[model samples]
Target chain A: MNAVKKIVKAREFTSFLFLAGLFLVVGIINPAFLSVDNISACFNSSMVYTLIAVGMAFAIFIGEIDVSVGSTMGLSAAVAGTMIQNGSNWFLAFAVGILIGVVVGLVNGWGVAVMKIPSLIFTLGTNGILRGMMYLQVGVEQVNSLPKEFKDMSSKTLVGRFTVYYCCAVLLTIGIHFLLTRTKRGRYFIAVGDNAGGAELVGIPATRTKVTAYLICGVLSAAAGIIFASRIGIVTSLSGNGYEMKAVAACVLGGISLSGGVGSVIGAGIGAVIMASISYLLVFMEAPSNYDNAITGVILITIVVVDALMQHRAAVNNRHARLAARTSAVPGGKEGLEQ
Target chain B: MSDKTPKLGGQNGLRRLWNGPNFRWNLFLLLLITVECVVFGATNSKFLSLTRIFASANGDLTFWYVSIFVTFVMITGGIDIQSCSIVGLTSIIIGVAWQDFGMNIWAAAALAVAVSVACGALSGFFVAYCGVQAMVVTLGGSFLYSGLGLLVSGLSSTEAYKGISGFPDSFKALTKTKIFDLIPLQMIIFLVLLLAAYLLLHRSKYGRKVFLVGVNPSAAEYSGVNSRWITMSTYILSGLAAGITGVVMTSQLGTAKSDLGGNFTMTIITACVLGGTLSTGGKGSAIGTALAAISITLLRFGMPLCFGINKQYLDIPIGVLLVVVVVGRAIVSNPTVIAWVGKLRGKGKEAKAGA
Candidate 1:
């Protein structure tokens, strides 16, 4: 019973329940969507979104945001795609792509963490610069005609009904979650985000933790970019254009507090699945694809409103409990006075 | 002696003027505009013509209009990314109302504005009353409104790509009229709006409440100011501005589409931030935003005309400018940097004494 209560109290549990409920509703509406294959396809399609959301989770955990994730994803994909299209070694292309992410992460971290610039503005700046670089690289053309093996790798599954990419993303999320919950160094992110001054007083390197969070976010986003290239098999200038917002929405849906110091990467992964499945579910429901954005928006608003109201209720309950304890304790004092 | 006294007094007055509120930022923007005009005019002599400059500036009236009211939102320490989507929503609403519903064009426009304001109120309610982050609410609002716009467009017989056109001549005259054949009607409208914004933001008690709320919301609440309402009202004002922009843009382009103003999000934010509005809120000015809008419009106009750079590549410079300028401001305003600089100056004086 205690464990069940704990599970119920966990924020991610609620999101997981929400995800299940969503699937059940969609499945009921369209019996065809209840198939094991179709359900697994939802997870498979969410591989890229999962990686991006998990990456985004780090930023949110540290109480900052990186609006440049989409551009970063686009830039890296363009770089990797161009290199691979030119018959370059795949590993080398991947290296350069990840290198681009690291450099951007460093610049963003330096601006936001070291230079003390607002994270939103700093990332917005980087977003523009990276987008410009992407345009310069891709020009008025899309990068296509990649090797079949590279494209086919996205379909290669390591587990039943799960692509290698999705499996790897899930494993990576679990690993990060373990590290975050079990390791002191990894926990510094939530610590810093919870209270930077207090964290500093306690000898935690708050700035360094923030920089590391951005680095991890950048690395993961770049990885997602490589996966995006392979999955889509074509890279356009507008590729990953609005994924940052989607990732943010995913993180929020996963029960990650925007104010930071809360949530797990696993929850973010779940949220990504939900976010990525919207279009797929819409199709099953026979709804127009144009409703995708509106549905996502509605879901985002609903979740956030619910989260706020819950927090408000909890605060009120805590105040009530405190008051009750105080008033009851006064009876003990009154008895002592009678004695 | 008398001549020297007047000159000295004048010098003192000039210094005071330079130190006045928002004057420095306005002057900086003026200088930037001057430099841009000179360089672009030097490169293309036709650029110096008043008609050409005004025409180019007039093209970006949508940005000016949106940023002017958005300055209020930013001053209240909130942002409205949904404003761009609101523009599209307004345009499509007007198009659908006039063409499909057979309503009067002006009545359609009024309806559009009302709907847009209602949209703003929804997001503002979430941000203010619900205590949700403004960024998340606005981001979601952007998606929601744009999606609604697409759905709305579906109702009309006109194809979304072709847009609705062939409005009444008098209605079209909103953008067509020019004063003295030198200035566009849009420019005059923008000026009037700018003045209204300036007065609302700088002169009114409501404006003071907005600033107080932005500077410290809890303190504002303690002082009996309804900070939430102020914050939410800013979003409404922004929506109203977006509605006006929609009408004017549709008039200017001689058509209305669901996707109109879809790409102006970055430009509007760029105008506000470049004009010296703090993204963290509590500090912004209408005059500064207006000047910044002018400077940006000129830059966008001048780059292609003078430097042969493609219009699409302009984001690079704007991005670099934002990062560099903001970072530079941060460094300059940092107390540690100030102290370090003071120490260095003191050391230099000591070194001079030793020498």
Candidate 2:
């Protein structure tokens, strides 16, 4: 039992260790890397990934994948940019952005729920479609010269340290944790993911639950896109080309099982920070920028493998528990259990 | 194989013509060609000339020219994002062997293919034997191979972006050579590749194993099949094909760049999905892939020709088409329709019983 607990703790804390290790490495490379300003900037920039990963955690927990999130984010960004250019107010532009995200999410949910298509293929398809739509709508002109309000968010440093985006990231993380732990919808998501048939037997609508997962993913991804647009102050067709991978890597590194039914919003956020720091540290260390991708890949794979091993150990422990329970029920049974 | 579901025939053919994978592929291709001819002709009458038409088509075809290997990659229930990097690596190698190393073009191409196969084998070993997820393994492979490509090219030239140009005329002649001075050699190569891929995938016994492994590895293993090696072999074939594509691209463009195939993985994967290769694996066809490549290539060139569409927005149509095809397939296969039809027929019986 003690060993099992140890394993669980290790599995949970590995991401934190990696995050700390990256921080230390960066600080070592450049003393100023640990400065409040630098740390704030890194966290602020990583907010996009954190937002998307939190959204993706819901889908991953439900045993589904959403590669289309990046493209969906792009769609929202393009929509928001176009709206902003057309003299739309901030409130209206934000609503349109969120609406596009929800619509894309609905398309994903509808395809998976109603059409019974696999999530991966359906999302892959939509990834292309959303990207195509962005292209058709935006064309070649980059949406530039943004309004003062949006630019202020991108350039402003909040609370004398962190940017507003970083604050948003913290708020999102805390909100997700509360949603998962306190809300009925959150428990329903886990219940459905843990066993769909069982959830259905208990009067839970598994399909609806799964669709909700995708819907949340859509909204979150769109939010991430809005933040990204604000940060960069530029809208390009390929802006969100590879952001999906970053989210997936973060979730995987954060002990979110790809097989689903388990993940933590806090852990995923930490994973995002770790990933962001790798690139940040590489620059501090004077390493080639390209090495950042390679290192990030390595860290992601390592975390995934460790998670898999932890799960395997848990399965073995469960099997052993059943065997011990059976033996203990027998009369005059001599059961010598060795750990 | 199930007799209960009869193949689409007669009236079904018309329906299938619009809805089936084959129909969509051909329709998209035709629509693009028509639009291209009309727009280019209006802009410049010379664009309508047979020579110019042939040139445009040839250029369009080159974009997805490497899609032949992507079909095999899809069949094995694996994806090789690294194949794009392999293309770059091979192109440079081809250049070095033919120009600097002074090897024959054919021999150089063979060497390039061999290297690609080795890289593929490494990735396949990890995926099939070690049970690593295809995505992670390939993503890592992409980085490793791309880095190597840059390094190798950098060894030969300082400007990695400019690439290694100035290949001998003979090497470019392979892509440019005309049979009867009417058709390009590149076209012939594309046809031969398509036919060979079809035969290997659809007709061969080993090919069937690939499908089984992809659909369900546990079931295949239980049935006394070594699904691992079969899956591994497909990656090897893909890598080799990437090498061939690299050589062809280098020869055709008269340059070899480390970044030649960068950002190409998404496009190839898009082509595979567009061709109806289910990402979940176990279902796809060479003919479907061929048509898909043609359509994608046409879209790349044709959209720009007619609508003055930006090249970057190309992902939009490909993305939309992918979603439409997948969602359309899903809707048609929805069980509610058949259940509704059964209920409608049942209502007639209930009414007669009441009477």
Candidate 3:
């Protein structure tokens, strides 16, 4: 009973419930959505978003944002896709893609952590530079005609009805969640984000931790890019155009606090599923695909507003309780309070 | 002491003027503008033509128009990525109202501005009252408003690709008419707006309150300032500016489309930051923004004309400029770096004495 209660009280549990409720409601509206194949497809398709959102969660955990993630992803995908289309070794292409991620992460880390530039502004600067470079390389051309086996690799499943990508992502999220919760050094991210000065006083290397967080974020986003190229079989200059916003939204939906130092990769993975499945669910509901952006916006605003209001109410109630406790502890409380 | 005061009066007076509010920054911007003009003019004689310069400046009014009011938003330590979407919303509203409803063009414009202001107020409420991050709220607003713009565009009989054109000549004259046949009317409008922004931001009590709120919100609240309202009002001003840009752009281009300002999100922020507005808030000036906008406009104009670079490649230079200028400013202002420099100078002096 205690274990169940703890599970119910977990922040990620709320996101899980939301996801389940969404699925139930959609299934009710369209029975076809309830099928095993379609349900598994939703999870399988969320692989890219899952990786991106988890990466974004790392940045948010350290109390900063990286608006350049989309551009980084685009550039990496363009590089990997172009190389693969040119008949290069897959491993070499993947290595080059990850190398691009490392370079971007280092630059972003140097600017933001070492130079102390605001992450948003610095990343936005890099975002523009990367986007320009992408344009220069692609020049209005899309990288296509990828190898058939590579494209077919996305459909390869590891377990019953679950793609290898989705299973690995879930396991990775769980492993990271375990490390973050159970390990001492892994908790440094939350500590620095919660209070940087306090963390430094306690001998944590705050700057290095922040750089590591951004590094992990960049690596995950690049991995997502490689997966994206394989799944889509084409890489346009606009491939990852607005994924940054969606990833942020996914992180928030997953119960991660934007203010930082709170949440888990598991929640982020769950949130990614919800974000990724929106358009797929919309098709079942017979809604116009054009409404996708509007719906995402509405959902984002609604969840955030509701969260704010709940936090406000909790704060008010806690204050009232503290006041009551103080008053009740005093003998002859009214006279004591007056004194 | 009395003798020193007299001896130092002239030099101190000059120093005080040099150190005056935004004086150094404004002078730097002026120097940059002059250098750009000289280089561009030297490269291409046609770039020196007054008529051509005015025309190019007039064409880029969409940027500075939004920057003027966005500077107010940034001063309050909040950002509005949604302003570009609001610009799109305003354009589509004006187009739909004038074409489909057959309303007067001016009335359509007024309605559009009102609606845009409401959009700003909504996002501001979320950011200020609900304590949501400005970036998130504005990002969501960008998506919502752009989607709404598309929905509105669907109401028009004209196809989305074609856009709504055939605007009245009288309405079109807003951009076409020039004062003295040398200066574009848009330039005059820009000057007036710049003056208005300067007065509102630098000379008004409300502006001081905004600065205080941005500098320290809880303290501002304790001091009886309605910080939330002040923050929200800046966003409204931003929305109003975006609406004006929408109308001006439509008049300038002789058409209205849902995506009129689709690609202007970064350029607007760049202009503000390049002008010395702190992205973290509490420090900015209107003159700095205007000068920055003009310099950037000239760069964009000159790059294609003089170097034969494609307009598409402009983002590279602009991005490099933003990163370098901001990072340079950070390094210059950093206390540790200052102390390091001071130490190096002291060591040099000590070595000289030992020698």
| Per-residue lDDT of model 3, residues B18-75, tens digit only | 8877779889999999999999999999999989888888777778888988888888
Off by over 4 Å in 1: A1-4, A330-339, B1-16, B340-355
Better of 2 and 3 by lDDT: 3
What lDDT score belongs to each candidate, Candidate 1 first? 0.89, 0.76, 0.88
Choose the strongest candidate by DockQ.
1
Which of the two candidates, 1 or 2, achieves a greater TM-score against the reference? Answer: 1
Question: Over the stretch A174-224, how does candidate 2's per-residue lDDT look in tens digits?
Answer: 888888879987788878778888998999889998889899999999988
Q: Can you write out model 1's per-residue Cα lDDT over A153-251, one digit (the tens) per residue?
A: 999988898999999899899999999999999899999988988999999999899899899889889999999999999999889898998999999
Scoring each candidate complex against the real one, what DockQ results? Answer: 0.75, 0.37, 0.63
Candidate 3's TM-score reads 0.94
Query: How well is each residue in A200-314 modelled by candidate 3, as lDDT tens digits?
Result: 9999999999999889888888989999999998998788988988899899889998888988999999999999988889999998776777777778888888888788999
Docking class of 2: acceptable
The pairs that clash in candidate 2 are: A128-B319, A128-B320, A129-B319, A129-B320, A131-B316, A132-B316, A132-B317
Docking class of 3: medium
Off by over 4 Å in 3: A333-339, B1-14, B342-355
Clashing pairs in 1: none
lDDT of 2 by residue, B180-219 (tens): 8878887788888888888888779887888888889899
The C-alpha local distance difference test score for the whole of candidate 2 amounts to: 0.76
